[model samples]
Target: MKILIGNRNYSSWSLRPWLVLRHFEIPFEDEVLMLSGSGWREALQRRSPTGKVPVLIDGELAVAETIAIIEYLAEKFPDRAIWPRDQGDRALARSAAAEMHAGFSTLRSRAPMNLRASHPGKVDLDAVAGDLHRVETLWGSLLEKSGGPYLFGAFSAADAMFAPVATRLRTYELPVSDRVAGYVEAIYALPAFQDWLAKALQEPWVVDDDEIDVIQGRVAPGTLA
Candidate 1:
């Protein structure tokens, strides 16, 4: 199997399937197409019909979209246990993942995922506060219901689905409750997350336009990326 991903620093969508594969210890060849330059368009077109990153190519199947790729992986490798075995938990997990896939447009648009950002950048209050509230509510409600650690008590697809948003909230310094903050920290501390961070820190290409806005001017205080 081979997976094509965008630059590690700014591609939250790309990170989703990569992290899921990493966390599950699924062996796959990785082709990281460094972005922030003009060459990515041609490369992305060849790998992904939609000209997007994070395309998964297996022996005879090609999958795009993080959620779709993950679902395909789960079905193909049932032993990986990507989702819960229990029917109820699995159903809830799917629900959460679907919500993540479709909602949170506000936060995504205002606070683009830049793991290398200096500080918790300023929140676009008008554009993002509502989504922030909804996300916080989602985390709080899930944690309160599940009672600890991850949203579903174990590392499931739901966690994988929300991992990028956790990074986004950390980057933008969105207001979140203590429980949600801890949840975000947990996702950040995962070994897969650490691996991605380490790789991102080493990347040299930076999109000048997006790289221009540095609210705190020093890259997230003590952040790894």
Candidate 2:
């Protein structure tokens, strides 16, 4: 399979399926498109019906959207254990992934994912408190049940769906409990995640749009250079 993605540095949507593919050692080709600038839309349109990044193109089928791509992969590689084996865990995992997929707009808008931006302290988190609580409650219960380094006992699609949230929490330095912070650390420490982060640090592109606080002169640029 070939996955067309935006830059590893800024595209959280692109990161999901890419991480899953890499984590499971599924051999796949990837093409990165600049998330900004002229012609990028045309480039995306060519590969995906929805004209979105993170489109997975198999032999004859094309999958758009992160969740759809993940579901497709799960079906294609059933033995890979992309989701949990236990029916209850599988249902909960799907629900968690779905929640991450469709909900959390408040947090998403206030804390845009910027791999190269530094927000040293909390900002606009109050506006997103409800959403934050939802995340924490969902995660806390799951972790308590699974006794996990991941949301589930294993790193499933739910983790992949929420991977960008971990980066957002880190980038903004949001005040989370020790449990949530530990979860973030575990996600960051994953070899797949670290590989993505290293590439993000080295990439030349800086998404001016995602640099929310920096553009507003609220926080300084967090670029490595």
Candidate 3:
């Protein structure tokens, strides 16, 4: 199997399913396509049915969307605990993952995921206050119930879905409870996440749209190094 991804520093969507594959010791290769510039769009059009990155290609089957890719992986590898093993816990995990997929627009827009950069105070707290509260509540409740270093006790697809959010909270220095902070640290400490972070820091390409400095007008476009 192969996963086509975008720039490591900026592609949160790509990181989700990739983490699952790596964390579960699944065998796969990955190819990086620049998120912008020179045939990137054309490449995506050719390879992806939806013209998006993080498409999973397994023989003739191509899976688009992060949630779909993860669900596919779980179905393909029944032995692996891709989600919580208990039926109730599995339902809760899936609900949270789906919420992540469809919600948190303000936080996501204001603080795009950029693993290599930190821009505290750049994001307007007022804009994302509600979203942050939701994050704290959701994560805190789940962590308390699961007694977790992760949302479902062990790192699962739900954590993979929120991994980028953890990065966003830290990168923007957003206010969160100690519980949420601990969960964020747990995400960073995952060996699979650490591997991804190492590659992300080394990436030469930058996606201007995802850079908070550029978005906030503090840094001129195309000026990032």
Candidate 4:
């Protein structure tokens, strides 16, 4: 198996399936293409037919989109337990993952992932308040229901799907309930995520366009941890 991904620092979509493969200790080769300069588009085309990063190439199967890649993994490796075992739990998990994939555009656009940078203050929440509230409610309910250190009692696709949101929370210092904040912290503590963060910190490349979200226009406050 092989996955094509973008730079670790700014590509939230790339992080999703990459984290899953790492978390599960799945044997896969990964290639990282920097999402900078004028050649990125041509580079992506050469990697995946969809012309996107995070495309999993397994034998003849090529999966695009984070959710699709994960689902493909689930079917191919049924014993790995990629989704919850219980029917009801599995359905709920899928719903949450789908919501994360299709919605949350406001938060996504306003706060791009910058793993090497930290912003400790809120710029403002009004712009993203509705999405923020829904996330809090969804996370709070899931945590309470599953007694979670993860969203569905164990680390599954749902957690992977929302992993980027945790990064967004830290990047923007966006307000969230203590429970949700703890969820973010828990995801951060995962060995897979930590490994990704270490590499991101070491990366010399940077995309100037991605840093525009830093409201104060200040330097990196500290390591994203």
Candidate 5:
């Protein structure tokens, strides 16, 4: 199987399913498509049915969307424990993942995921306070219940979904409680995540749209060095 992804530094959506495959020891290859520059959009449109990155191509089947790709993987590999094994735990995991998929717009918009950049204080706390609270509440509750270094206790798909959020919290130096901070560290310590981070730091392409400095007007567009 092959997964088409965007630049490692800026493509949080792409990172989700990719992490699942890697963490579970699934065999797959990945291709990186530039997220910006001339013809990039057309390139994505040609490669992905949804005209987006992180499309999984397995033979004739192409899966668009992160959650869909993850579900497909779980279905294909039932022995892998892609989600929590218990029925109740599985439901909770899916619930949390779906929430992450649809919610957190305020935090997401204000602090776009950029693994290669660290801009503490760039985000306005007032703008994303509610979203941050929700994140802490959700993650804290899960961690407390699971007694985990991960949300579901063993690095499941739910953790994959929130991996980028952990990055965002750390990158922005957002205020988080001790428990939430520990959870973030656990995410960073994942070997799969570490591998992704190494590649992200080496990425050359920069998507201006996700650059906080540019968005905040502290750095002029196209002036990044």
Candidate 6:
């Protein structure tokens, strides 16, 4: 099995499957495709039918989309326990991941994933604020129901689904209360998250389009530096 991913720093979609595989201890070869300039576009077109990162290729089968890839992995490695065991918890987890997959366009657009960059207390968009509020509510409710640490107690597909959002909230310093802060801390403390960030910090490829300048705790209109 082989997994094709994008840049470690900016490709949130790529992080999903990568984290899932790592969390479950699934042995797979990783192929990192740096998404800089037209190279990413051409590479993705050739590598995946959907031209997206996080494609899982198992011999002849090529899987695209983060959720699909995760579901496939869960089925393929049932012993790894990727999803919740309880039926009710599994339903909620799937719903949470699906909601994350479908919604949060505003937040995603304004704060694209750049795991290595930290912009302290710099939230300025109302749409993004609303999305963050929803996320906090979701996280708090899940923590309350599951009892500490991950959203579903043990790491599930849900955690892999929301890991990028956690990184976004932390990097941008978005408004989060104690509960949300604790949850984010747990996510950052995960071994997989630590591994991914360490690899990302070592990479030298930087995209100018992804970087933003800040003034007085707000992103200023400037090209990537």
Indicate the TM-score of model 5. Answer: 0.99
List residue ranges in candidate 5 displaced over 4 A: none
Stronger candidate by TM-score (3 vs 6): 3
lDDT score, residue 149, model 5? 94
Per-model TM values vs. the true structure: 0.89, 0.93, 0.98, 0.92, 0.99, 0.92
Q: Mind giving the per-residue lDDT tens digits that candidate 3 earns over 1-225?
A: 999998999999999999999999999999998887778788889988999988999999999999999999999998999998999999999999999999999999999999988888889999999999999999999999999999989999999999999999989899999999999999999999999999999989877899887888888978887
Candidate 1, residue 81: lDDT: 78
lDDT of model 4 at position 138: 96
Looking at model 4, which ten-residue stretch has the lowest summed lDDT? 216-225
How many clashes (backbone N, Cα, C below 3 Å) per candidate? 2, 0, 0, 0, 0, 0
> Which candidate leads the pack in TM-score?
5
Cα misplacement distance, residue 134 of candidate 5 (Å): 0.6
Candidate 6, residues 109-185, lDDT tens digits: the string is: 77778877997655566768789889988989999999979999998889999998988888898888899888889
The CA lDDT at 212 in model 2 is: 74
Model 5's alpha-carbon lDDT is 0.95
Residue 173 Cα positional deviation in candidate 6, in Å, after optimal superposition = 0.7
lDDT tens digits, residue span 1-225, model 1: 999998888888888899889999999988887664567678778778678888999988888889899999999889987998888879988998999889998777667777787545476676787888888888788788888588877788889889889988787777788999999998988898999999988887675434425433534422322
Q: Candidate 5 residues 1-225, lDDT tens each?
A: 999999999999999999999999999999998889999999889999989989999999999999999999999999999999999999999999999999999999999999988799889999999999999899999999999999989999999999999999999999999999999999999999999999999987878899998898888888885
Kindly report which residue stretches of model 6 are placed more than 4 angstroms away from their true locations once superposed. 214-225
Off by over 4 Å in 3: none
TM-score of 4: 0.92
Local error of candidate 2 at 187, Å? 0.3
145-200: candidate 2 lDDT, tens digit per residue: 99989988889889999999999899989888888888999999899999888888
